[model samples]
Target: MALLAYRDKHILSAQQLRKLSEHKYSCFSASLLDPLLQPWWNWLVSQTPLWLAPNLITIVGLILNVVTTLILICYSPNGVEAPPRWTCLLCALGLFIYQSLDSIDGKQARRTNTSSPLGELFDHGCDSISTVFVALSACISCQLGHYPNWLFFQCFCAIALFYCAHWQTYVSGTMRFGRIDVTEAQFSIIAIHLVSAALGPEIWLTKIPIVGLSWNYTILVFITFGYTLNIINFLKMFTEGGSGKNGSSVAVSIASTSRNNEAKNNYETCMKT
Candidate 1:
């Protein structure tokens, strides 16, 4: 077939493929707490059947998010109805499931020795899309939707922060998840869900008066913290000369060195096996 011929013509060479895989793995800059959670994650990954592909796990997470999106749409219905209190519980549970699955897929790949460039691309792409689901859920949970501006701002800030973090990774060869990574973000959103269920959605809508502003939004304060961390990271990168003429080589060197260490560890572990 013509399609088969085109695919064959564009297939990557072995060297190119290896470099691509290395690049994919190098893009991750984990959170400080990742190690604290690693044991638990390793256990979870060990429990996963080898027959289950990493990409399948990723799809399961995406499906959970889609279900959550539908539930939000039904409960909010064009934002005309304040979602019932129980909706918060549903969203929290969905996010928990999605986050857990998301965390496990990479481990699954490593365990199976099935890691690939495509898997990394698929994982990041899914995470980016899930950001929207989490954003809308946050707006619904906090009842911030009542104020359109706040709702829009919350969604925009969440997605923008995610983008900026990855962009930093791409340019600086380090994706700093900081003390607060996507996992922490998920936990915080879950907390918001519980608070909304307990105190009612309008609770976060209450604004405290600030000196310069008529009122300060709680969600705004939360987002400001996220932005501040990213700004600090950008400054650190700038100071390191990662922003200079040698940026590309430096970034590649950083990624290569990290990957080399990881590969060495993996090889040693395999020999022990």
Candidate 2:
């Protein structure tokens, strides 16, 4: 009972609950691969039994993804050492499974007539955590930990971009995805894992012909460039503000503030009485 009370007091305010109840999910994805994978996702979701809950599917995928990645981490905690070749393959398969399951959960929810804001919240929460593991696992697969600074930057850059993606959504009332977005990144990481599994992690150390930089460093440069563009795009959206009146962002914060003020006023009136 105490734990429940504590959760009620700290987890969310009355104003937040109201906002959450009123919230609707809006997103735009220009991902190059989404349409390509739509048929597969549809078929997979169709095979899912009506009794299966979407949240359960999401959690199962997240668990598989994290567990498989953890197996690789156990072998190469520093990300510099290559785990067993088979672990890389396993990690790749885990990510693919996670991606597929994550994509279809919403479809299953809709199919079962159980779609809700809570489900979206749960899905995004899992994705955020999965992003960290995915990025770290990719770095290990590429043996980026050999360059400690690059490894740090790569992992943190992926995280920062992910945060900015949600922040942009908060400020604009819409989640936006560029042409080369999450799907492309996920597939790229899977390919990296496959290459490592096939040719060994040392393959990333091979120097490119004229550029002279190792394959790992060359790939890092390309990824950094992509991140830079994503940052620029996010900044542009923030500057443009939201679609709301007076170019306001989502009104949740504003509404919460107003409610707090009202509550304070009411309290003062009660004290005077």
Candidate 3:
């Protein structure tokens, strides 16, 4: 079947096409920072030229983010050594710009009357790639590579949580976000970069006298707890089943039913003729 698909010219199946046509973007984010940033996003979109395409804006932001992160990686490839203070600042700025632009792209599409399912796909595709870079950059900034296993765990955990978020969306047909979510996490990383820039990455090596733990380790512990909670939440949601009829995954079940109904109608029409 895999080889047969490779031989075929078309990628998407008829049912996939039907699902795409019927697709409606549904997202629910109770993010702590999104509401606060809405006004800023609205103003940014207003200033954006009508001639500028939404996709172009998204791509530019993603490129800037990747390039800045790559520069940091080049300086500290092993993640054990701290990159230059300026590089951390540059990375923070790059991430901020990317976050701002990402928030406004959908608004730009709606403003231009050019919204489509493809736009959503493109936006999420960029985000999925960005998650890895962001995690790596954060780890490097904190010099987490000194503990190689921890560094690997942090990066892969980030990627896994991102994937699981989309998987939840696939099942429930609605993207759900908690109060302290992506925006909050991005800002926290930006703060980490800024702190590294000002006080130097060595600051994270400072041990808390009472706790006898380095700042880096303390933060990592907190982040680990957050990841554990997220995994538990995802597992609970998965086991509870989706909100769709008969406890089925919403999008897949709806698409399957629609395709079946369409085929039945076609057969009935042929019989009448």
Candidate 4:
């Protein structure tokens, strides 16, 4: 099953690596991640011969995601005057751990011949839960204390991102975010949220100085604008990005022929003097 491998050696191109966060698999949503995980995939491929049998990275990530979600829920920022900094730190760490391992397990599979459709499904299934929890916690924390509008927008934006991701995959056979996709945006968002979690909600919140409106809420309005616009841009690409070609054998044949010509150009470049 090349689709599901023993050692998950990803085939991600360089540009995709930088924007892995925006990368999406469309169908499996996360399963398509194989093409965007190069260095981590490479590491797992290196372990192919021995077939390392440590606990699965996806399992570890799932556990951490759950742990973080639980702590955030049980000790919500709204409920407590201040949840323990340690608890907040741990929650942030849990998400971070999830982020890193999220990229690691597929490579492990491809490297070790452990890639299974089941594994791919499991990996993504857990990620869906992770997204839900992370968004919920962040919103609850902000809403409980000071930034209600921001919380509203954050939660809405996060869900919007996921929904758009699903839509892109269904329509294009490509999981995209803005001009990017899940592969390009995932790690970057993780970094952004993790830093926010560490700083506590106030740092970004203070950016607001509205005469009447709370600046936090104002920020959310703008964030909403950005989020909605990107989703729209992604949709627009469907209509405008590719040349409009209907279902025609000749058109497809021409397109296929063009692809070959482009490939030939690439090959010649590789062989150039």
Query: Which numbered prediction scores highest in TM-score against the true structure?
Result: 3
Ranking by TM-score: 3, 2, 1, 4
Which scores greater on lDDT, model 1 or model 3? 3
Clashing pairs in 1: none
Please write out the lDDT profile of model 3 over residues 1-273, one tens digit for every residue: 988878675688776786687778898999989999999999999999999999999999999999999999999999878899999999999999999999999999999998889899999999998999999989999889888999999999999999999888878888899998899999999999999999998889899999999999999999999999999998877767587767668865786778789999999999999
Candidate 2 clash figure, as a count: 0
Native-to-model Cα distance after best TM-score fit, residue 244 in candidate 3, in Å: 2.2
TM-score for every candidate vs. truth?
0.76, 0.89, 0.93, 0.58
lDDT of 1 by residue, 1-273 (tens): 999999988999775677776664554546766777778878888899999999999989888876876787688855436677777777788887888899999889988999987888899999999998888887777665567876777788778877876667666655556666777778888887777677766565565556343122555675778777777776666456354245653456666776788899999999999
Task: Choose 2 or 4, whichever is better by TM-score.
Answer: 2
What lDDT score goes with residue 261 in model 1?
85
**48-154 per-residue lDDT for model 2 (tens digits):** 99999999999999999999999999999998877899999999999999999999999999999888889898999999999999999999999898999989899
Ranking 2 against 4 by lDDT, winner: 2
Sort by lDDT, top down from the best: 2, 3, 1, 4
lDDT of each: 0.75, 0.91, 0.91, 0.58
Error of 2 at 164 (Å): 0.7
Off by over 4 Å in 3: 1-9, 13-15, 266-273
Alpha carbon RMSD to native, model 4: 12.3
Name the candidate, 1 or 2, with the larger lDDT value: 2
Tell me the alpha-carbon RMSD of every candidate. Answer: 8.3, 3.7, 2.3, 12.3
